[model samples]
Target: MSVVKGLLYPLPLLIGFACAPSALGAFLKDSKLNLNLRNFYINTDYREGHAGTSKAEEWGQGFRLLYESGYTDGKIGVGVDALGLLGVKLDSGKGRHQGSTTLTSDGDHAADQWSRFGATLKLKASKTDLRVGTLMPKLPVLVFTDTRPLPQTYQGGMVTLRELDDITLTAGKITQVTGVASADRTGMAVAGGRRQSNDFRFAGVDYRTRDNFLLQYYQAALEDYYSQQFLGVSHIWKVTEGRSLKSDLRYFRSRGIGANAAGEPGYQIAGYTPDHRGEIDNDTWSLAFTYAVGRHSFMLGYQSVSDDSDFVHLNQGSLSGDLGARGASTYLIAERLQSYFGRAGQDTQIAQYSYDFAAKGIPGLNVTVAHQDSEGIQSFAGSSLRERETDIILTYAVRSGPLRGLGLGLLYGELNSEVTPDQNQLRLMVSYNVELF
Candidate 1:
């Protein structure tokens, strides 16, 4: 069957079973339904040397409804999940809206409203669960980002096995994805590539030792593009009461395959490449240390990217061209608010400090400050460049009151770069959740 037909054919059957009297007992008893209301606003001001616009600003409200039905009572159970998303443009003055994935575009302006619906059919047996359709994977190889008012979604099937003690296994294949600001599903590709790949496959294993240590390994491939492997290790140590330290290390190796390796037209990545050939061959690594005591936490980290090519991941930004299909996340410590710091041959240093207000009688409140300095970025012309960024964020959530589920957040960030335009950004968000069960 075709991909579209396969994805659509199971919906009616699942819905029919959901409405049947025989499936109502256990299905309804353990089911959950939630509605989330989010108000978001963002503003970016270009400090110097911006070609297109001096500023980009937008405001929108999002409504998300999620429903998860309990599996039928049996050794092998079945269930269904559904998601509904809606976004309404509240403000985006003319000449201020950037065609980003945060909002859909209409002609030369932002769309007034946009919405989409998704469904998934799931099955469970013992310690293994399988889900087909509408995925938001959070694995090290791939992550569905939710930095905007609406979150991105993928069309695929994923299987998770947890039958062994202190071990987890995951495997999945993704065919298409709907961008955060788009209602249409599109194929996946890497940065600066215009061709799309429908076959993105991944598998991973995670093992946790009894002594509070975690080891991870994952392999992923974007068919006809690139293949990648990741290795990670993390551990924590306790020094005294309420004092602890954490150490995390991660590494990735990627290489071009198929069309990308053959240097075919429209299949090459856009970045500083070896000998000006746009092929993927890179190794990236990062190490971070964090210390926590009482209400204070401090972190320091360093990251380096190989000079052959930029770090590779599934990014659809350039594939969709001007349709606003952008925004992606990477499993790197240098992924900041304004920059990823993943440029070819780049090295980045990171530092952060955060405080929890619960120790001072203000529960559910926290603030964080972070900074990054990056240099040795290989430009297309074979010269090096540098950039820096700093971010401040504060958040508060009502702990116990009539408005207990309400949350408010504020963020401010600044970036100065030699390769791109200098800019400052600010974001404000308010969110509340309602239980519909």
Candidate 2:
């Protein structure tokens, strides 16, 4: 507590700056308009465990527009940002289906239509800012999931302060969620049920030193569900001439809170609650290391789960298990594959390898492979879940041609689990990014 208080001790001094009067044109930057264009194509294939269940493949094209308003010409700057997103199904229907999104119906075929718009507002003062409305947050406990045709967004208000050197403070309350696959925004709640909590709340602080060392502390609460705390650290070091190694360590602790735990007895009777105790407490930790040599990079990581269920995902939903799928995510605040971590008492081992074509005189080609294995899961007597996942990624981009920013990727994954369903996937993606000043 003392450490945290010391970090926030500068708030009063920074508040003074925000309240101080400013002369005309003294604190404002001219407003400007920026446009970015993206053309994206994706194809996915899914193979289901049961032959009777529908297997699927899907393809789509999407366009995203982002517009930002320059700060107001005032001491307390104000602005707005509008994001326009549209996804059009290029192929889909009954024999081969894709998703359960409202945008798609009973057919394996897609609706042949495009879905679209979300926006946000901002207010800034000194080194602090408040953002509200359509939001994509990439925080430790909550992350916007965007692994499909569209990007997921949330409805929330958040404040960030960077008034302290090498330190940042963040807090927020969220009310609803907008899924990546649909245009509708649903009331927010815990992932496994109809439970809803008063605006979800969170606060955290992180610091990164000049020496490439990072430290973080965070707490997040979901009304009637759970409250979680996360702490993490990372360091990057040069291991040899022209070679570097990076280490990342992370931990999360959680407990059932309010309604989720107290009322769990009733839910348990209905086969909803999976554990006892008004609290859902578990300890999760991981250590990852990466080393780079010329154009070849290799990473190895290990994680442990001390609970009976998988780690939490804010708005986790089922995937279609389609043909080609890519699970990569962007945005620092969004959830990572690391989020869906464990099923209590489970330990997982991960390995990954990648190569850049730059070493081979192929400017924009790269390849990667990753695998994970987990065990010690909860199951009927004499059985434990043994899941193995393998992923392959291939990417190519134009080097110095007219299509400088054009990029293409092929992703493939296969999952084999003991006493668990089987899942296989494949995905191909193409994208172009253009910047206009």
Candidate 3:
């Protein structure tokens, strides 16, 4: 593993220099570098129930450096991009440390610091581009999580083509991933499965019309686990000069494939399954509507999960043996700050309101509040359960002067559940970015 990691880390840099030696001037002239600093603090209190710990709190400072080189001038242009990430622990003790959310664990306490580096080699020809090495994809079929101090990263290769007007095509395959809290990379797996699969493939297409309409279809499969297909549509209508309404609809169908279908030992999924057999069979759908007028915006949505299994995604959280691989995100309406609300046979309703203070003379301030109620959940013990969550967020950014580009934010969330422990969480953050030539 160490040998493979070492070779992969410098492969992009080598390839870029070798392929674009003659166009070094253009690459150097168009290069860009940036540095971002972040200070994050989080506290979670378990209001009821008994697991082990009652509360978890942590504070950390993070640094991210990014560099991007311009593509060489030619029919097939070549470029390179690099990333460096570092996280330093500010406050965390044995009792206060949580499971690899913001910081990795060392013995019984949190690690003092952690860091990693990655690079990508890219080539472009006509309206198509190909990238290899580290990737952070944000698509309907697969999206990377960045909720913690450091963002999760994947090792893969992808190609994107925009040859047709108002249309896009994408395909990719990922072999490994490094979690946000850990610096080590591991094979890919789902939430409840202990086995790892190095082959995950996906392809998608997006088409847009002239009349504010978008249509999408995507297919993905994790080897020996499950296969999934997604369909989505979106539209926007202008009610007046300052008012608009938007509607979004999404659907997914998934079923067990190789090992999972055969009921293998380590390939079984977690959550509620029919007949107590851990097979992946699910159909999930959601619809949302948003109305915006002036500085205020309102949104409402509904989601439904099939009773056969929980909604599945590329989740490594259940791989307890892998350090820092305990966090993931899904493209679902129920993906809240504290709880995802993605359980078997669960149905969710969501409401949100946000206000931009610019209309009230505060140009860089904003506030948002959201609520979610979910019920009809089927637990593994053959019982029914329910859960709900409420979240509030406030943010301010300095738009000018010495403190320009500085941002401050606060978030609070509370969750009440019938099957799990009730909890409340608070988060504070400050961030700034610097541009370097």
Candidate 4:
């Protein structure tokens, strides 16, 4: 007891004084916090872009305030993190209303204001930590969806433990979700909101043996919504002293149970599914390979889905790049996000190439191109429906000067479809940020 107390007696003081000795209170001169500002532009209806290059010109401004406090301790360590997020209308409205980004509420310009925030309490002991309240769960089981201007947050408690070599364990329960793009918090549920569930639970284990190998397993459940299981394996091996190749394989399977409680009998996929079924079943797989030589790297990946209906998921259909790869953001005039354009034989494939400019004297500059081919839709034919796309993206950032960290992106695309208008698009974006602590 004497030894234990001696060791922990300095905790509170350290926390109180930036991890000082027991003599210090909870105030430390080195403690810090900061504010950051980000300005963004989004325009989807530019006569010079979409239908011309996939570039839609839209814009907005975001403000974030972050605060963190060290712990004051004894046997327990305590800390807090607070965040304030505010997004104001800068350049979004009808005619140029890109999509469901809340850029426009009812046809006119979006309200000039949108904001939200959350607070968290953290406790630490040895190498383990417990956190409660608002969290941005990043684990694969419940990674907060952040494919927008803002990031989504969840209300939950999570535990991370690491006491064994080559192994780590994690578990958590989430009850609600606050979308990064909206002001309201919605209850957790399976895809479509019909198979609603509130008690989101998950647990996982990861192992690494100091080599180029990794293994992972996780299971997640949404009380009355659905259950999912995941398994992953990856590794990198040296082909030669100066050359290596790496491969990653991932698989996920999901089934429904108590998803739809109030929906019609057949429409109980999860508990109260929207369509039909007492359960939901899906399997997804991805195979990727990379080769590295000198300062250059090459990568290739393929992913596919095998189901008549769109794979079920949370209200936001983010899985499966159905919205178009390269961040088309599920808004390519397709009507909604995750709108899978598939038929009985619908398949998607990706081919990409990249170059590193740093090897050639220039830093922070690169280019990439990808093409997607979709067939087996069994539904479209003739000169009315063509399904194919070729995309080009060029990006550069200023490393110094007033524009340090300033980035510019130019994107272009070519779309060919039988029934829809063949469209070409282009887009340009400029943004910067500053920190005030």
In lDDT terms, which candidate is top? 1
After superposing candidate 3, which stretches have Cα over 4 Å from the reference? 1-19
If both were scored by TM-score, which would come out higher, candidate 3 or candidate 4?
A: 3
How does model 2 score by TM-score?
0.81
Going through the candidates in the order shown, the clash numbers are 0, 30, 0, 37
Tally clashes: model 4: 37
lDDT of the candidates, in the order given: 0.88, 0.63, 0.87, 0.57
How far residue 123's Cα lies from its native spot in candidate 3, in Å, is 0.6
- Give candidate 2 misplaced runs (Cα > 4 Å): 1-48, 51-54, 101-109, 264-279, 316-341, 380-383
- Model 1: weakest 10-residue lDDT segment is 1-10
RMSD in order of candidates: 3.9, 9.1, 3.3, 8.8
Please give the distance, in angstroms, between residue 186's alpha carbon in candidate 1 and its true position after superposition.
Answer: 0.1
Give me the displacement of residue 167 in model 3, in angstroms.
Answer: 0.4
**After best superposition, candidate 4 residue 267: deviation in angstroms?**
7.0
- For model 1, the superposed segments whose C-alpha errors exceed 4 Å read 1-13, 18-20
Q: Residues 1-437, candidate 4, lDDT per residue (tens digit)?
A: 34224323433443443344562355333234555555555433222323533434456666656666666555677676666666667765445553345332333335566667777677778778888878887665666654445567788899898878888899988877765555556565544443234688999998986987989898988776567787888899999986888887766676665634333442343222123444455555656777877657776766554453334445532312221111222111111222233222334555666666778887778776766655443222321123566767777877888767576667666665433445565555555544444
Total backbone clashes of candidate 1, pairs 3 or more residues apart or in separate chains: 0
TM-score of each: 0.96, 0.81, 0.95, 0.75
lDDT of 1 by residue, 319-410 (tens): 75555568899889878888989989889999999999998899999999999999999987556789899999999999998998899999
